[model samples]
Target: MSEMCPCGALLGESLMPREMAEEGIFSNLLEILMSASSEIEQACKDSNESVDLDTCLLLTAECFRCLRNACVECAKNQHVMRNLGLISTSVHLIKLLHGIQMKEELLLTALRCSLQFLGNIAAGNRDSQNSIWKCAFPDLFLTCLTYNDEKIVAYCCMILFTCLNSEKVRELLDPGNLTVAFHVLKVYKEQLESEWSFLIVTDHLLKCPELVKALYAKLSNQERVTLLELIMVNVNEKNPVTSEEVNVLMTHADFLAGCFQENCEAVLKLTSAADAEDEEALVTIRLLDVLCEMTSNNGQIEHLQSLPGLLETAIDTLRLTHIAGKQAVNIFTATHAMTGQEEISHPAVGFKSHLIRLIGNLCYKNKKNQDKVYELDGIPLILDNCSIDDNNPFVNQWAVYAIRNLTEHNERNQELIAQMEEKGLADNSALESMGLEIEKRDDKLILRSVRKKPS
Candidate 1:
């Protein structure tokens, strides 16, 4: 009873989170803000030359810090603070911070606190969240992210993730915010909070078709590929038909398939400036993973099979290749055989194997893709990979299985393999020349035997 009384309360209860953020506390904070605002305004007018407004910046930052502390747990405090016009004031402070000449410490600190203050005000308050949207906060925060200071960029990620929770914020950011948000997810995902903030926002966007359409229109080719990788990891459907995002994504009309096609071109240009990191194999693997996931559905197989150059891209990726000195080299890549010491197959081998499986899956019941695979010179490549014990054995096993799948009932492919076999004996066959044998399995043309598991 004594503790509940305001006068005789325990110190912990003296200021209910609400009382600690009382109108009087707000008034004092507002006074400090007003003082800092005037000083910043004066400095802005006095200096056209960029010079640090050391005292002015610190005071403005401290004002935001105080308000942030006060509003930490109290929803009404956020409401009251935003109603007091602090949202606009924080925006102005951000503008001032961007404009003023300042030391790195002061500028970074001011930006962090000012943005943090905006985020705090947005907590659980729809009107305050919308207030942030109406202001230039998103654009400003995105701009700060490109400055390449990881800490500062990370704070921007946190702020954007926090404030952009409401539908109002999504309406304003929709497609465009995805570009900034995903860039952070791609580059700074490791640095984000335990929640994986970037992915959370992106997953939300993917669920909304309108949001994804906007994202599709705004992202660059590389960014699109990066986003595609995240999407692949996200839409991990064991039974893909049951998934909403995947179903919605499929409705986008070759949107994802086109992304895969572009990713292949990007990988093919492994030496081009366009593929700076030479992440070709990695991106190639990501595309294959997504395709495999999509093809798992009986409905999606035909759709992916129909994407021109998509299956062909998978076929092209199956070739044994390596990156050497900024050039993509076609190599025997017989790691263990050549080194006289067993070495692991390059990751490209595994990715190539995944591509074979994807194409194989696409051809499951789709004759057009089977024909397309046949036309893409896929027969020779498929047979060449039939018994590769030197590198990854699964590459050989999946290749053999793919050949079986491709030729399951397709007479045209069967005929092509038979002709290739006849030619193999007449001349040094592409298969025999490479020292691989072609065997006829009752109704199938395949390697006599493949290492079913890794060698």
Candidate 2:
């Protein structure tokens, strides 16, 4: 007899973790699924929505029981499941029971597993993602959402939200029919996973003016802050701020300034009322971050400058964070993707850099604010980041820019940098990158990043 092929068991086990396969779970699961296929097929042919449903339900329940294990998700790939002709049946069952559940017991037993099957399959498999997108429409998901079952609704959310990061899957996200996702958020915002899906769904909804304004009013203060932050950061660069939908937040100076001031006050309150690393502090920092980005316009800049002490308050908060720098840096290195991993900017580094940039903007050609920053003892903080810090990779780059901006046309600030340069304290690497040049004019020393050529 010909040798038996090892591909079937090997491919199935490839989906499972090594430890799981060692315990024989993959082989055991395959045996259980294969043993019931004939029964499942026969019962499906015999049963209707009403008559003779028990045998089909029982076989499906057993399959669901097996699929509920963690390894089942790994085995959902077409290449893996095609080993035993299981993928086709699974796909058919998912489509057949898209919105039809016989009873609470039956729904819990079979339908939930089917939805989760589709979801898990789509997670990292582009082909499955494409197929699920083609099969599972907004109307089917709307029906799932409208049902009273939380687990079922959560599964639908999972399945739909799985591939949103993919450009191909984003095409399947119809912005007009996003009420299904909104319904999940409206009902399950407190659930952490649902909030993630909600963010993904509404990210695509930024161009839809009516939904965004309505969502702004519907969500709570904290939720509003969180959602707006997500929207601001993740909107497609090609389409960013193009429509009236997202433009209101970008253009309305009064409201944007209010958000900035309110979040500042909140962060200040957090200093006394809560721990520095608390959730409230994080939220305040994020909102302040959004406001910092919004201050690009002349109108917004005027409103921002009018808020006395807000800029100083932001500087002080950065100083407070500096106190816990060692601990925070340790935490970041342990959790964040490190250098040589990829060229992606570390979030912790970006947050600090953005704060520095905001300070730079505040002091940009605004001599009075430069005086204010100097009075607030911001020079040392800027200088601390001037040298290459092990924890914060981009600090020197932004610090150089901030220092260049702060010292622009200001003799006292220029003197401070000249002293640092004399003492070997300023970042030479940063200066070199900026193309720094120093000039001796009459008796005073002048430092500039880019030299003006004969103009």
Candidate 3:
């Protein structure tokens, strides 16, 4: 034991896990781990020999590590350990150590090792996950989450994330337990190693409609902000973005949009710069992004538009940002003149882009929304937003998209744009600057990129 061989690391990183399991090594390690605490207690009782007790504890910890390594990529070994009852033994060992009045380093190491082994075995083994989860839910996991040790907390999160399933999600949704679950998720959110653990769990919970409504009803405003941010990240990071995924968010679009409506008003009233940092403003920005994602789906867009004043509020927020000169000062104070009283500060940058993006998404292929924008005089405002702003990256592109949608197949909207040009009310400078121009091609106004000039 003086020098643990590096190749020992390769013990569980086995390509021949089935063959290794057949060798009966996992059973032997399980025996060592199960008998460890008893062996140490026997050593202490027979004689006050610290070395003997220490050796027994250390050997047990090693057994935990070896079992963890063995189960890493080997489902067979994970099944073997679960069948051999390592789950209950590890749980008992942890409870025993934690109950000790005098905290010891070896005891802590053993507890951490037990947690790590459990997490490893639960990774993708649904049976093992269900077993450990049964022992952990409502109490053990909550206690682990409160621990000060970062490694212990992270391991606990890892296990929770691995074992999370529909049944556990229902238990987690329990009113008494939901808050604790959110607390654990918040803890996981802060840990660098396990940050995605929060997202994974939140994503799963979000898929449950009951959990979604409960979350909204029970979560405080700040917790709601975090939940919204996690939902945004989860949806955005999904590859090949599926319809089922979009549908989950859409199912709760109205609830989320109601949040957007309330927070949008609070954020838009930011007369002083410091108000931008308030929780309302923070939630507003996240809601904007989340709503933007929701509106991207055609299935969700009509429902979002159908929400009373939702479309109007989006346009109004954009108009107010422009009227207040919020977008310009946020990007650059020197480039655009800002009157002291009219200037507005936002909680974070990219607020305008997300806002514009939501408006654009709401208008996508919906003539009623297209007409609504025209009625609210949002066409010129959106056209004005086509100008590039450093704080709101892609605001220009989103604005162009909005204008395109606003005028598509709608003669009234199209003629209004033509009339804006007649009155010089439209700012085509932003579009022209990007080597694009709006022209009437076959009675349909087309915003086409100029081929002669590079865009």
Model with the higher TM-score, candidate 2 or 3: 3
Off by over 4 Å in 2: 1-226, 234-247, 250-278, 292-310, 326-349, 364-368, 419-434, 450-455
Model 3 misplaced regions, further than 4 Å: 1-56, 66-84, 101-104, 195-199, 216-223, 239-246, 297-308, 326-346, 384-394, 427-455
Error of 2 at 284 (Å): 3.7
Model 1 misplaced regions, further than 4 Å: 1-15, 47-59, 104-107, 147-149, 165-197, 204-225, 237-244, 251-253, 259-293, 296-302, 316-329, 332-351, 371-377, 389-393, 407-455
**TM-score comparison, 1 vs 3, better candidate:** 3
**Tens digit of per-residue lDDT, candidate 3, span 10-57:** 443354653365537877876786677676555545565444555666
RMSD of 3: 5.9
Q: What is the alpha-carbon lDDT for the whole of candidate 3?
A: 0.70
State which candidate, 1 or 3, has the greater lDDT. 3
Going through the candidates in the order shown, the clash numbers are: 0, 0, 0
Top-down lDDT ranking: 3, 1, 2
| lDDT tens readout by residue for model 2, 216-301 | 55566666666656555543232333454345444433344445555544443332322435554455566666666655544346
What is the C-alpha lDDT profile of model 1 across 178-202, one tens digit per residue?
6565555455444545243454545
Error of 2 at 149 (Å): 7.4
Candidate order by TM-score, decreasing, is 3, 1, 2
